[model samples]
Target: MAAIAGCSGSDGGSGGSDGSSDGGDDSSSDGSSDGGGGSSYDGQELNVLTWGGYEGVSQMVEDMGASTNLKLISSDKEGFNTLQGGGASQFDVLVLDNQWAQRNAKADTIVPLRREEYPAAQEGTIIEKFNWPYQTFGFDGEQWAIAPRWGWEGMGYNDDEVELADLESEGYAAIWDGDYKAMAADAPTSVIPLVMQQIFDLDENPMAIEVSDSRLETLEETLVEMFNSVEAVHQGAAALRQAMLEGNAEIVLGVGNFELSQLAAEGFDWAKVIAPPEAGGWFWTEGLCLVNNPDLNRDLANEFINACLSPEGQRSICWDGESKGAPANTAAFDAFSEEEQKTIMMYKDKGFEAADEILSGLDQYLISPQQEQWTEIWERAKARSDL
Candidate 1:
């Protein structure tokens, strides 16, 4: 649980973290922000941050580093308050939330990845297709955060409780429908992303927004209506998996992952898909990011990223061990046995809308403390039985 966090280029004696440089580190060997940050390298002492589900990244990165000059230190923070209070910069590479990557990259909280540093960056994953023109800190012309891992955001129907037909008829509003209503009001932060997406989709959908002003009000009303109709909220994926497996939920929001996919293979019946049939699916690429330290640790950090996407590393750790998900590297995908590839496909989407475009104005992944406060909105929704 603790090991999942990387670096090395130059050797500086100054910018050492006295713990106050929470957001900034000295720049490294390349001298530019690309390979540098704080004033010191501090040996192979790597610090990492990933959400709860990705707890396995530690052993995976450590194994990858076995053949390289890097040793990464990793940690997972479940709630945003930990990041909000500061001290995030105490680590080197951060597997930040995909949405914040765009907002923070420009602010210097996380630095840009040079095209030259990653040979596999382009052909490997969704990152290459997302960027074209480089700006101050982002890849390509638009804003971006980090190279993504695999796409998610599938609709989940709890096999025991909800009927698929009813689930479809109500759309996002279904979470608050019927006996399952108890779970809807208090659902975890994960479900809010789905609600916001539904809101984003409705406001943009031709059917939902034919007229401009009045209809917009109607859409907002519907969103607020659906948002307030919940009774319970549960967060961890393990808990969700347990709920479904034990028959506590008939239908719920589904995100593609090993747990869900494996559960289905073991005879659990469930269905999932991308949201807004009119628009493409949504996915998240979980990859490495520089903490912006320019010290002896620069070169090592660069090496760490390289090893992570390496085909050999991908084959050894991806999905087979604690680390689960499709490999971002093309070679890693190819290296997957037919069975492994098929297992990952249960979650992968072929023609997802370009993340840069979908996230252009309203990227939902950007869950700042204020946005996460949707708990209040949800509580209100639960209070009303119907709009």
Candidate 2:
């Protein structure tokens, strides 16, 4: 079973809330003391600030003869803070959520990539859907980052306790059915968008967080009701899993298929994740971004990104055993085993066409300009639940 720690924020960026920062030994040395003498990158050190489960990509880069210094970050917010606070000088690359990647691009915290340099990240190598501007990772007519993996936020339910037919028919309305003990993951980024979708009946661009005064009021009301009705709001995957296994919660909100996969690994195959057909669920794409630093090795940074776009690098990210996601590389997805594809909920009986259709139906997670308001509303809703 995948053990979850206390959650601080949504997994939309990190993929899993259980990620912890490795505060020690940021540098990694290759066993060869000669420091890859013959390689073009010879003694160059590639500093990477990445999501917890994605540190494996650094090793792939290191194998190419560049020494790497890796630091694990738990959320995109943290990554943004680091870069904006002058931490960009410490790292050459950052694995960030698409929304934050765009924000950083606008803020000049990260530099744009030359399409000509990264052949692996060019068109035809990655899924075409992710190639759009401001949708996956492109911004201001330049590619700000290369998205390598993606996932979604949906409801996880115990099949034995809740009827699958009801979920499919009622959609998100099933959570408020009052028939099952419900719980939610304490992730405002994910939860707020989901509740917004339900209250506004927004099927398209549901992740849009900008709202007028009147619309904000309506969202607040819906969130208050949802929080109050749930049996508990779990802070970590472990708590969510424990609640379901112990029969404390029959329906879980603000989670994804990744959690369901974790449950299945524990021999509890009854756990399942579903995006309601009507409102749909939230989806997030994580990208590899180059930090904006004059001292940084641009060639080596691009090389690291190219390596990550490779089939093996994509596999290291999507099937890392700790956290699983859908690879952005078409070749990487094609290489996945039947069971691996099923586990990531990328492709099952349906082929790539079906998976692409599913991606089309979902909303991409975007950074809200009025984030303070969103956070305030979420806190108010949680307070209502406590009452």
Candidate 3:
């Protein structure tokens, strides 16, 4: 299924006609803004690569007086592969997962962002948890990416078949219960960490990247067991949702509240997401990064980033009618109506403090240095014929 498009309306927050707070002159008919004698990137094309349905970002960039060429990608792996294959120079801005952003920063495939240049990128403008030096997207004392959207991955269960209290008490162990048929996404990044937590019986910091050789062996065994126990392994949110709706599985793993919300909207009110009590679920963020292209127009690119961080921009990027994820910019909550805020998984009636408190309890998804090794282990587990 195609990702849903963002809800329309709103000029993308306070600023000049170009969607920037720099007090620039009105954009000319040709889509070029003169920022108080600053250089106008006339006729320049801002090439952006992001997930499908993030057109709100494109609109923000276009409003900034630049022609935009937006390329939609299906997965973080696809985006990372594109950059690794020397395609970084083709786009000025790229939106990727936090871990992928970390990889690109380490590979020098993306440039560091100057926080001071953009008001929206500065300290206190966005959620404090996503600020600079946050391990997920920051490293080497540089801000490598700006996370504009975030959500947590947990088990989605049919309320009719499973008790919330039972899942919470059992935590990761709930997936191993032989009586309950389970299904999961094919995403190793989303599944492995939780598996590790289960194997280690860890109550906190389930995202530690370094895995010792002995731990790897044990993890392999556990993964094989978990895989064999599941009803089937599916790819994409659509397939997972289908399995649950068809009663092929009573529980789905590696899905977030966003998916559950989508299911509820479709009249599957019994669908619900829960972070296992013992090992809090994993949280993921979508970050916007500057591609390391020498030919890139830095000024316009920065402007685009700034615009996306605005209140209206956050609403456009984070909410689509059915699925509501938290915006990195807290001020964006103001753009949403009370009903809309209540629908947001993180925002609910309590507001930003509530969101922050919930996030604080969840584990951040981090880049595992041995990711390839983990994938190999996962594949080997999946290949085992004996249950």
Candidate 4:
């Protein structure tokens, strides 16, 4: 999402990777049997905390308005710690990035989801991805939360600024190839690894992380090199997009919101984004993890997820005819025109098929350990570079 764009892939069904569920109405083991109050509005207050820009809940409300009358109350959190502190269940649903699930689930900050209890989280293509090799929200085969949207993790460039061939062939060379400055998402402890991930992917033992004491030296070395060229670090996607729009920055190095291409219809340049061919990671597998709240509106939260997964609900969240955040509901693809679908489709193509040893190896090398050691070294590396 930051400068070097590599998004986690999600879009109802783009056909990438083997682990994700088909995401449909089929129930998963003794699922939620609780009957939600049918659409009477019942004046119930449903609270949800999520990353900024998620449309899953609001769109669902509109979709089920005729059937589930209760209105959902939602809020936004920019980071994970906010969700870890006690009081997550106060809201009916908590939508968070998937990476943080294991930690929070263990702390009991978020509760395991009873897919059988809620209709939306349990049904449709949207929530299906959670049933994987890493289901963190629930226990013994139950789900903890749902994934309403996912991002595409691959390389991107401003088409207007560079040719696609050079990008795919040169790999990071494309961004570093020119005199142009390379800007990436910062919070080195958090974002630097994404850039380094691409670098390690190009080396021996592509699946190995450079985090071990033996590997730590390698992580430091790789980051030091990357820091030499990185420019300003964006705070968030909106800020990143605005940077590109204003000419304050020229290139990014992470997941792409292909829907942004639709901005061309409104005059935003179309030539900036490019998916490098060397290999990349999907954006973090974002799922509906939670921030504990005491006033959880269990019933409406369930309805909210179900509605957003609906075809009609998915269409409601589309921006400029294409959904900015990829919808997990396979049915949502219909929301965009054929062309918009084509642009976004590349993320799934690249990720599901590309060499992922770099990303998987990184989990052990830098990101896997509970401690944030590499994050610190990365920050010092950043300080040295002044980026």
Candidate 5:
């Protein structure tokens, strides 16, 4: 594993772009670099490879007036798979799922975060529940990532097409309910197992990749049935949204605010997103981590991350109107206008407390030993989508 340089002290107090340090020589010396053979990103480009989806950091940094050569890339693959495929040196920073912190830290793919040294990395600005290291973003008493955005995944239905009362009674069975045509993401790794876990009252954590062979046998049967009955199980969110808009699907499984909010913004007022009462819900947090790179431009990398954690950065991430989710920066909620807050359902009347209660009752995703088996099963289920 290559040794990474300590983060450059680019907190908001410094001068550069919008009070952010721009990798200048006078920047406070926070940590030491590995002095590796490769040149620093000081005069070169900074490559950022993100997992899951783009988090808007490239634009945010540029907006903050950064002059660093920024190259942002997005990957649909899980963070662990990216690191396993030798992506560590390819990118200087990774905006990834919070769950990958432990595995990546163990693999030495990410550097320990000294949040105390950075002004924008203040944990106090983050939601209280997410501030706990053991609960959200720490391993072995050290920090690895900064939690920024979070949301839940479960189900979405068009109010005009399906009765809420009927869905409440069916719970996880709503996906298989013959009355409504179903469309789901083809990835059974999270989609099918999560719903089945809810159906049989098994583990509620969607991140749990492992399952007992006997349990998987039953899960496979249940998934085959659902896949065969559905109109089509698309591979990504865009396709699933198309299916819903074209009237091919009435219910979508394994969706979250990222999709529902955009759909509503597009005038799908009848769309409603929820976790079945019986299944609770699955929650995930998006975090920013410094990749372990020998040629890392520590100053620029830290500046980019701090910019995202700043109050303004938090507000822009959630209230952008196009992309929507609960900002991990709790203070961002108050900064939003009344209408904007309501748009994301963060208002008093929207049962924000009630929604938070439901999310609290849910379990975080965890790594399970049955991960490989689940992947194989998911592939089989996908093949049977038309069956």
Candidate 6:
């Protein structure tokens, strides 16, 4: 699962903790010299920097007989900082949150898309809801990226260990019940507001968290309490899953669908993912962007992106594997069998409408001023957790 994706920085700009660029090594793209007068880049390699889970795309591209070598790699906040530092040449494609997307677009760190070039990005191919201007990424009619996956961040609990009824009834408060061993994904966007919601009955949008002496104290106090309740605080889903499997944690804070799906694939289906209606969660969409790398074969990158957005690519990602997420393409959701959709938690019996309602409750609340504040307090909270 792609959790709270962000980097410590000033408003709308990416910067590392030490204020320097860090990411993938810059390399020249070597296009395959296929025998078709160099028209086909079938055996070419496309360097990709993402938050993981693109194996589906790679597999699908291969199935189509393209034989493209997908140099799949992972990244985190550092990747964002790297992009902002003008390191876009290291990779041909990047998967980023819309907030980060805006920053890259504003900074001109990525390429503007001409939809006519990418067939998969056209109207009938992409999901209707996400095909509008700037729906994924754009600025003043200039498109830059397309959404491949979208989901919410919340709690994932062991059903056999923690009562589902308790979670539903008490909402996010169930994490602190003192009955189950808990662990949290360490991210300010999820942890801070979640603690505020569980402890203080906060009903406002989490992105608009109020910063004040009293609130800060309450947050600090609550974070300490949460830290005391849990075994460890982690920054990655795989780590959280390992903690749960090792019996160190039975309930996980900030677990999302992507993590749950991956866990399910590994025979850990005992956990149930939930986004409480009361406390709510963050709704986010991750867009796929083409890096404006001059040495890279631009045509190959476009072709790879097109193949990734195809129904097969989307299907491979949303289902048919471990890396599960809600598909950005509506048709991809339909491609799943009745049981598969239910198993993946993509559609509850009411079809996509029910899914939409659940997603509607979550707000895309990452903005300026508050982001810097959140970062500052988060560092302090982590330190306090040690105490």
- Best of the candidates, TM-score: 2
CA displacement after TM-score superposition, residue 10 of candidate 6 (Å): 12
Worst lDDT 10-window in candidate 5: 1-10
Q: What is the C-alpha RMSD of each candidate to the true structure, in Å?
A: 10.6, 4.2, 8.8, 9.1, 10.1, 5.8
Q: Which candidate is the best by lDDT?
A: 2
Superposition-based RMSD of candidate 3 using all C-alpha atoms, in angstroms? 8.8
Ranking by lDDT: 2, 3, 6, 5, 4, 1
Compare candidates 1 and 6 on TM-score and give the better one: 6
Superior by TM-score: candidate 2 or candidate 4: 2
What lDDT does each candidate get? 0.41, 0.68, 0.65, 0.44, 0.57, 0.60
lDDT tens digits by residue: candidate 1, 43-130 = 2455544432322333444443421112222212221223344544454665544444554554455566666667665544534433
lDDT of 5 by residue, 1-387 (tens): 000010001110000111111121212221211212233332344556542122345555444344333332222134455666787776777765545676678778888888675664454756655664645558778888887666666677777888877777787677876679887765544475456656576644644545567877877777877887777766456666667788888888866555555566666666666676776656666667888988776777786677666667666665563535667666556666655544554222252334466566566644445656666777787676565
lDDT by residue (64-148, candidate 6, tens digit) is 3444443322333455667667667767877676566766777777787777876656655565556746543667578777877
How many residue pairs collide in each prediction?
Answer: 62, 0, 1, 63, 2, 2
Candidate 4 residue lDDT tens string, 84-110 = 544454445555454445555666676
Model 4 stretches astray by more than 4 angstroms:
1-38, 54-56, 59-86, 114-140, 177-181, 189-191, 201-210, 236-243, 246-250, 258-265, 269-275, 289-297, 317-323, 342-367
Clashing pairs in 5: 207-365, 210-370
Q: How accurate is candidate 3 locally (lDDT)?
A: 0.65
Instruction: Please say which candidate is ahead in TM-score: 2 or 3.
Output: 2
**Model 3 clash pairs?**
31-65
What's the lDDT for residue 163 in model 6? 73
Give the range of the ten consecutive residues with the poorest summed lDDT in model 1.
Answer: 6-15
Q: What does the lDDT read for residue 176 in candidate 4? A: 45
Clashes of 5: 2
